[model samples]
Target chain A: MKIDKESIKKIAHLARLEFDENSAEKMSKDMSKILDWVEQLNEVDTSNVEPLTTMSSEVNDMREDKVGTHMSHDEALKNAPKRDSDYFRVPKVLE
Target chain B: MEKFSSFDEIKKSLEKKETDCRAIVEYYLKNIQTKAHLNAFVDVYEQSALEKADQLDEKIAKGKAGKLAGMVVGIKDVLNYQGQEANASSKILKGYISQFTTTAVQRLIDEDAIIIGRLNCDEFGMGSSNENSAHGKVLNALDESRVPGGSSGGSAVAVQANLCTVSLGTDTGGSVRQPAAFTGIIGMKPTYSRVSRWGLIAYASSFDTIGIFSKTVKDNALVMEIMAGHDEMDSTSSRKPVHPYSELLHFDKKVKIAYIQETIDSSALQPEIKENTLSVLEKLKAEGHEVEEVHFPLLKYALPTYYILTTAEASSNLSRFDGVKYGYRTPNAHNLESMYKLTRSEGFSEEVKRRIMLGTFVLSASYYDAYFTKAQKVRRLIKDFSENLLADFDYIIMPTTPTTAFKFGEHSGDPVAMYLEDLFTVQASVSGVPAISLPNGKDKSGMPIGLQILANSFKEAELYAFSNYITQITS
Candidate 1:
């Protein structure tokens, strides 16, 4: 339940978030407290219990395969931070 | 002749042409402006609301007004209202405009409801107190110094203060009912998937249900009747037939109610709330309804299980907010890696980041079974057990919160204690059952005390019937 600073940093990296040493130390402390609280679930016997997926087990209503777009190209790109023409622009992955 | 207050009274007045929709809209706009210090609204669509009100007035003249003809409404910041800033009160979505309307809001519009503004809320619906909102905290209208139970704090305040007729709020684990309790109004979270989640900003998909905050049970019932139906757009939307909840509120059958002994007898609940809840039960029993005390030992585990599952889902749901596609991007980032990290770290608040980290840790390779899977299994146990109890009991009544509205800085220092504010309400979210909070009584300070009524999944009609009966006798 004691989430160390290094572990917090690794998880932050995995979650696409960055924290300085100070915030990371704070996060480590907060997570330890929260996780320690959540550790009480271990006291319950959930053996052989299936993980509940959705709210209901109702069969998903399937639809025919069809091609459609919710938004026009312009509308879709409207909120992008950087966009060129119709595509979102991100930093170049390759040199 | 009496003052028009509730939705039905307003509807009658509008139909009789005693008052026009435009006048109603103007009155609510004035109220919103006057109560601006409450910080309930993130943005007010003044022009659009007036224009819609004018059109509805025309429709009324022609006898073609829609179901919600003269009603004015406010939407929570988390729902997309099309071309409006539905930012979920977070900095990450600061400048984002919704491209499409959520099904729920669209239905409201179709019914001739004028949407006055978008209400504030906890950032991405995370915090128990409204203080987490990036825009600013929403003060409880009852007492500005006290916190309005949140993340639906603004929506609750809007209704409680009469800024709008009814406001839409999303409840993902006590967001709707808790705040409604704090503000002393009727807040109902319909069964999960009862209302479509198509354009709702996701917090926890399974638990994210669009709820309504209104002053009367009938207003909530009517709105639920209008909005609850199958939407092909949202796969999780229930395909079952939507019941006529508003019309069915007069089912006078006696209800067999159960109150959890642990919840009422617990030391955590404040004595005032316990006394009020017990009084309400006694009132129900006095009405010849069967009210029993049920032993619920699993009450303690509901909170931890809720946190684990919701945060795990939220971590995955919120990952889409990275800088590239939309929302806030760091001013300087040379590479994609730094861009993602900087954007997220700068965009999210400390609470959000902590939850994301907790979620990531739980779903991490080493602790997946111990946390995520274990929580999921426990979730099933809670859901099934609660549903079985609901099968035998007509309704489960409990105190909405352990204590009433807390002072501004009371529990903000400890996240766990703040999270425990949901101890009594999360059972409904975890079980996907329909639950409602109504003004039970008040503390000595006159701050409201709310009692919750819960029914089985998709049985909102029965829930409303019981609520209407309770309201009638109590009033």
Candidate 2:
């Protein structure tokens, strides 16, 4: 629960966010407070409890994979802020 | 009168041509305009709604209309209705027009339900109050200064204000129920996966459920029947046959009701809320129904455990909204990493960013076992408690919130306090049980209080039965 600025910075980076020093300081304090509260779960007797990964008791409700009419290329590109003729444009990923 | 009292009433009036669909749509449009100060809607498609009403009039003339014909249902902005922007009240999703309709919305359209407009909500369904919405806050219809509990605040308010006959809302952790309680309307979050999530923007996939808001339990039941079913596109949608909820509304009342005493007995409850909820319980007991107190000790940890699990899943689910795929993109980035950083920084609200950061931290390899995994274990303990408790009772009852609707900014500075508003409702979400909030009484300020009822998973019929009994008694 003792989060520091460095830990906050790492968490931001892992979440793909870039925070300034001020935000890091604030986040560190806020996160520490939250973690302190969440740590109360440790006192509960969960030794006999099984972990629940999925809520659905019935599984494998898969459908037959068939070709269906999906959104058109233009329609899919309509919402993109940066788009090319056939693809979404983004900052260069490779040199 | 008043454009018909309910959808069934509207359908009959439309069929008999006592009032045309155009008249009904115009009446609701006028109501929406007069109540614009409530900030209940993000967008109102007046022309589209009128056009749909005209089409339904033709269908009625040709004797081809279905149930809910010409009845307008306000949609929460998170749902994708083809050709309308599904912004989810977030600037991040601004101008994002859904190319395809959600199966649930489409089914309503096919049944001749009019899409009146899109209601406002918390950005990405992150906040319990409507104040977090990028479009601005939606005020409670009953009291302008108080919050219409959110993120489904607008949907609940719209129905309360008579802007629409009913509205669809998504409830993750009391999103629908809390707002319904605050606004003095009926809201039901059905069992997880009971309704399709295909068109819903994911909040927490495990707990996100499509719910309905209406003035009456019968109206909510009718809307649920129309919207509930299996959808192939949504992997988690139930393959079970959809039950006829309207028929089930008339089910025999030989059912047991268990008042969840341990959960309600917590010291956090306000005296007024406790007294009002207890009175409602007394009414249920006097109706010749079996009633008892059931204890679930693990219920205490549900709030923290829900936050941990939901935030962890949210961090992963929201990762797909990077600038490269869609949504807002920032200019002047030298590389993909910088672009990702700037886009997310500008697009997401402060609350969203905070949650994503916390989520990533909790789910990180170093802390996964201690936080995320442990929360999942606690989630199981909660679910097991529900399963065992439900074996003895047909439904469980409790106060929907510790206090009635609070004034705006009452808990704004303290996020933890705002989160505790969901303490009583999160248990049902975690357990995947169907639950509802029905307006039971009012506080000293005249703000409404809601009585919550929880039924075992896929037992919506029993939940509705209990709700109908309460509705009859209260009416």
| Best by the DockQ measure | 1
| Model 2 error, position B458 (Å) | 0.9
Q: TM-score for each prediction? A: 0.98, 0.98
Pick by TM-score: which candidate is best?
1
Window of ten residues with lowest summed lDDT in model 1 chain A: A52-61
| Residue B168 lDDT, candidate 1, scale 0-100 | 97
What tens digits encode model 1's per-residue C-alpha lDDT throughout B1-475? 3344689989878767788888888888888899999999999999998898888888888989888988899999999988988789999998999999999999988988889999999999998889998999999998999988899999999998888899999999999999999999999999998999999999999899999999888999999999998888998898889988999988667779999998999899999999989998999889889999999888889999999989999999999998877789998788888888889999999899888888888899999999999999998898988899999998999999999998888887788988999999999999999999999889998899999999998899999988988888877
TM-score of chain A of 2: 0.91
Tell me, per candidate, how large a share of the native contacts it keeps. 0.79, 0.74
* lDDT of each residue in B220-241, candidate 2, tens digit only: 8888888897887888888777
Which model scores highest in lDDT?
1
Error of 1 at A87 (Å): 1.2
**Chain B structural similarity (TM-score) per candidate:** 0.99, 0.98
DockQ of each: 0.78, 0.76
